[model samples]
Target: MPAGELFTVPPVRGGTKPEGSSRNKQKEYQLVRVKNTWCRVECRQEMPTTWEEDQVIVSQAKIGEQVTESGVSWVVKAPIYFCYKVIETQNLLNPSNKTLLYGHVSDPEEIDEYQKKTQKRFVVMDATVEQIYGSKVRKYFEAHNVVYKILALETTEETKSMDIVLHILEEVHKFSLDRRTEPIIAIGGGVCLDAVGLAASLYRRRTPYIRVPTTLLSYVDASVGAKNGVNFCNCKNKLGSYTPPIATFLDRSFIQTIPRRHISNGLGEILKMALMKHKGLFQILEKHGKYLLDSKFQSTNVLDCNDDAALKTTRLAIQTMLEELAPNLWEDDLDRLVDYGHVISPELEMNLLPALMHGEAVNIDMAFMTYVSHEIGLITLEERNRIVQCMQNLELPVFHRDCSFQLIKKALAERFKHSGGKLRLSLSTGLGTAEIFNNVSEETMMCAFAAWQEDLGEHST
Candidate 1:
């Protein structure tokens, strides 16, 4: 048989028809396109035969219609909507009873009860993490009899591509995951979370998944956001979706396993949030900045819920992040406080990837913008210097060679389009407060960049 052409169909004549007659109709009509008043349809048979009322017509005025040139009228189904929540927790690797688990380490004795109400689980972990805690994770699962498949991969800035995401998708399909009950678990830093989250969003056309961030950056920033994507064509998060995980489990315990630079990298985002929205958080970072960078909460790590300072710092950072994100989960509003230092960070980060971590780039961005604030009198010289000094104390980079005035101008151009034709540049008016701007001259930006470079040289020497 030859291929058929695509043609519109008209609704059946007479708005209503007998149900029994349509159902028993000998001839069939395949609908092409349906509209409010008419439906485009085609007849496969050579000639019209007996029409069964019930077969074609679903209701009195809908679906099947009476024979006539005028089409019938019907109602289309209602639209669909989705909603979910993100949570914070400790030691998510521990088994649990409730579908949604949050907060603190689980007691060994409580495991028995917690596991009883659990569902099957699978994990997609960063390969590096598996090397560090593979045995521990396996032991925990075995102790609880929680059957799970682990798919570990190298999730690096360079490896954050669609090809990597597709590989994860293949692994997810192999598990034949149950979309609703069985959740896919992702464990690692931001890159790992991004790849895994993107994979979960695709599987079964959006399977529920969980996020277990293993780094300071992921804990405070990445895991909490609904944006999930992999890079493409050298653009950060070019191929992505705004799909929030079913839940996000924050375990400070995981940060203990990584080096201090990663912790400092995370402090970058914490600092960004502090400056943008939380004055208290900004003050906390300033006062306890050094303590946080070097304090050992546990014998094994930087995070100890027992350490009052560390707990306060971690809680404030997470809380501030949620405050900025909760209202703009989909970024429908581009004039966001959370975009504080993000205007130029994406390009700067990618340009310095493997050498400069994401948060490090953001710190550099914030530092430059703080200089911009000072130039415009939005912030005082002392305040601007204080922010830079705090970043320096935390071991975060305040300046990067790649973050030049020209680069910033170019980045702002791209940002204007991304932000819906508005500059929407977030600039700090003072500590813990920021305002968006649609215009800032290149001369002012260049001066700020120059001042940052000079400060960097002074600090270095």
Candidate 2:
């Protein structure tokens, strides 16, 4: 490329030999003055340095440029770095736990300023959460003299839409927030977190939002990630952006109020991370699945008699999920193992909306993928059965009647089309290791579905 460039030799060439060494040194720099400051600036008159692979630029530092008669080519090499905090706090809404107020403020001076200021916060909460903790949340903010507006919506899978995002935007607009200083707070389940995150990402072209996950599902699965969206046109997360929160405050005590079924529902997601990356986590879920469900993730701090299995389980789930998500937040690489159950689950969940919880649909997808793994020799039948049994033990439905082979095929097709023309099927080879394969055949899918159906069809709901 350096040789083939449209050249201007007198200007571009450097380090000429003839009458050069001292002259070149003299020509290499020029004195410049700006703002009462005088300094020497190097005039580099050489070929631009660039890294190219397969005629495509992977990365370049400060960039090499090529100038043609028609235009000047320069890369605007600005890479974005976003740092968000995930704090495991206790009694977040309690007057003493100031994390809900000043935790996200990084600088001590900023925190002091934030505390001194009568803060105005815009809160988007799930209706269920508002009903349960509205008084405490209100009292906490009021205790600090924070001027706040809480918009409690019936945020469910059915209500995960852009219209709700607009509703949040309208309320946020009316509140007239300081986009830089005051961040929006989202307090609820995954759906509420997602919708509020999307709204925050949209308003002012990306304002900061804080996540307060109330359910176990949100605490482990949704609250930590950057991806946020509302379901669009019968597709799961079809309309979304990769915008993370300024901070995610995880208070496990909030999980205590959730129903027993919701606890099991959340385990489906934790199971996903385990089956993909951590065998130890899988075993923990395997051993304490029922105990967790029974206790609703109440740690020994609350239950006193039980061990701190709840803390370990949630902490492990979050760590493993972050291990996958932090590097690939924008999904620059499509071969994501975190997308294991997500492939077919999106379609299946949309198809069976209101009937199946998000994690249940994801479990069904994982169950079938496990069987597919067996069929393709990626996993043994015993391993597949064990995974399924674990699902059952966790009270997660492994089979949904609506998840037909045709639906599976269609979901894979959609995934293939969207995921750069590859299935990118994240199938587990064993308990905690997985690979993304693009070579899965339709025949194998049908066979796996048939076998999965034969094994668990009668149990389908």
Candidate 3:
């Protein structure tokens, strides 16, 4: 059936009833176009519903819907509303800062009421993070007189599985959380945040959750979005959901404890947004990336929140990410520029799990795709060189020995299969600009691969 508008059924009609409805109260609907468009369901307290289709003039609703002469089917088309903050605050360990408690209150109006209640939270923290800040976190919570359970897990790519999610759920079930107001807090890297999000989404069918990223990678990449999952069947984030958190609290000071390589790993993601849509960001990383890395994103005062390359880099990354994520939160539109480095990275990252960091794998994918873009005449040699040099300057790996042509072909094949039969690969047409190209030929790919290997794979073979 062709897609059209979905109209509400008038009150219990005393008209001719459709066959097979069984009873007067029972409504029937022939399901069509629902997969392609959002269809409104007529819901009443006790009345039945019937559905069919008709081509009519459009409505002000952005998502169109339709119905016709079929059994009544009721569906609540109410949109789920939840806003999360990606805040930048200092001394997350200090009870005086109240950074840990901010996730509990979504709005300022709730602050006074929240302070009056006995607060409690279930926190899922990365083992590494817990090792460094566990005592401090406990002290902060104790000082606030907040009842909290902090569960530490080794949430690494190697351990990103359903088992980990189940383990978290087991703890959450024991905690007897109040699903509505009390949130499951995630404190760690992307893996920790992803696992905790999945667990929170599963528990009680969508309990509220918060993300407090302690690594630069998670701070800039994972904490800004709603996508969460664990690896399954050897695929990265194979089992996942678009369940966003109630808030995502970011603190750059957390990066101080992480290794320098991990800092570089996060920059790989920052560089991604830069290459895709922000030229000034790319230039900043190109010039002052070393400063940001050495200072652990605290080149200026962490509390200042202004006047530094590190500050600009984090904000730019978050803004660019949100600009892409907010409208397409559910990924209703599969063609996304934010997927620039993700096409091959998932397979490549999983194929070499624990060896290559998520951002490293992504940078490698981006690096090769850069050559593909160059071969397709989307960018100049100078532009391609600048991107590669930028990656190298940020201490990111541009190529991998394990990332072979066969692997590339296989990854692309999987991507093509999953992406609605089209590659829909996002490639940089120029610095800070990119486009989704579904028509890049295998010939172009092979030529690009050969050039990419020659330029960066010198130590591979």
Candidate 4:
């Protein structure tokens, strides 16, 4: 299969009749190019008059001749529109067919059964804080036919030490009897995923792994992407590789056991996504903020609320965000859609590692960025107030006073230096648009932090 031969057209579902005594109802269709397959999708409806109006058709349609209205049909002879070059395969196989694996992690027994059926090695990497749950995971694996291993690492700042991570990986590698045939499966939160993902990436030069993301943060943000890495020299995600997992098992069931603060931390990340990229998403979060808060503060679970509508809403928003952003993960077009407060968040996490959860740092970074947006006149005072209020409603830290301003300034300076004077901050002029600017001034950052501090003091006193 060659790049020149692949095409796929959109499948038109319903049809509409033509207007104004036009007896002939034109058929609509979309032609898209996959790897090496040519597919034509057609519908019984009026075809669009222009290429811009019918992208699905124009994507694969080769032009003919010029045409005009006034009861005349003409075609414009033009070159074929090539959106992307399809990869050439050795054989004419279905190269565009993606395999998806979905499973529930609600029951450890069910998870163990799935692993046994898949014939993959089940390894439970967990935080020492979650000893009981980790034990259950091990027990479930034992009950089934799957071989299991438990690497209990502490989630504290000290455990994120580079030497500790490396040692853990070494141990896992050394203990494995059959490295080539067996794949690794990790079950836990972001830290567990990161450590296990890093180890999987290194073992046998990148083996496949299945991720069972237990926490909300991992479910919505971390585990889906192929990015696998660990911290280096106390820097957050400094050492990492873009190695995607074979599959990700999202079990909202485990979220019931998470503490209130951790759950709130995850919501903080969710709120950041809503504020920066999707206006509709913001509305959804606004509607469900109370539900999430109650779910965390009380023993109530989100799954138990209103037919699980809150969880569904949150999952939908997260899925949309991932679909929009994941495709652009490797592309260097930073300004397109990476503007969810992660730029400064990483630096802050690195500087304040073991002190702040990643989502907590992101929450603070989003507030600071909003303040910068206000200072630069990119956003109005009312919008800033609304953003701050939304974060407060979610119980996320919305002020810079949560951390030392001087330390933050120093970290920003270090970030600038590390990126070779390029200000890699994800700033937004308004909702649904983000720009990565390297021209942000130190004075602008200082002013933003100062304003945030003032707001925090006012609230406290």
Cα TM-score of candidate 3:
0.85
How much lDDT does each candidate structure score? 0.74, 0.84, 0.84, 0.60
lDDT of 3 at 59: 28
Report the lDDT tens digits of candidate 1 across residue range 1-461: 12211121333555433433543222234443222223324344332235333344322121233332334323232223345555545555654523333222135555454546644567888999999877767766676566667888999989999888899888778877567557788889999999888888887778877788889889888988888998888888899888888778766778888888988999999898889888888888888877777862222433554456677777787888777777788788877888887889989987777788889888888888999899888999888988989898889988877677778988899998877887887899998888888788888888877777887844555
Give the runs in model 4 whose Cα sits over 4 Å from its true position: 1-120, 128-130, 177-181, 296-309, 350-353, 402-406, 417-421, 431-433, 458-461
The digit string of per-residue lDDT tens for model 4 on 1-461 reads: 34212221223255323332353223334454334444444533344434343334335453221112233232322332211111111111112211112122335665465545543354645664246466555445454444556666664444554565577667676666355445576767887787777777777777766676667777777776667667777677778777766667655556667877777788877776676577766776677677766664232344453455455555655676666556765434445344466656776776665677777888887888888888877888888888888777777776544456666676677666766666577666775455666777878877877777777544655
lDDT of predicted model 2: 0.84
Looking at model 3, residue 359 earns an lDDT score of: 90
lDDT of 1 at 141: 69
Model 1 misplaced regions, further than 4 Å: 1-86, 94-119, 296-307, 457-461
TM-score for all models, in order of appearance: 0.77, 0.86, 0.85, 0.67
lDDT of 2 by residue, 143-232 (tens): 989999999999999989999999999999999989999999999999999999999999989999999999999999899999999999
Q: Using lDDT, give the best candidate's number.
A: 2
- For model 3, residues 1-461, the per-residue Cα lDDT tens digits are 12321333454555544433444233323323332554433232322234333532222233322233545454333356657777777777888887678655757878777778988989999998999999999998899999999999998998999999999999999988777778889999999999999998899889989899988989998999989999998988999999998888888888999999999999999999999999989999999988988888876654444578888889889999999999989988999988888978888898787799999999999999999999999999999999999999899999998889899899999888988898898999899999888899999999999999998996545
- Comparing 2 with 3 on TM-score, the higher-scoring candidate is 2
For model 2, state the Cα shift of residue 408 in Å: 0.8
Instruction: Please report, as a residue range, the 10-residue window in candidate 1 with the lowest summed lDDT.
Output: 1-10
- List where candidate 3 sits over 4 angstroms from the true fold: 1-76, 107-109, 303-306, 459-461
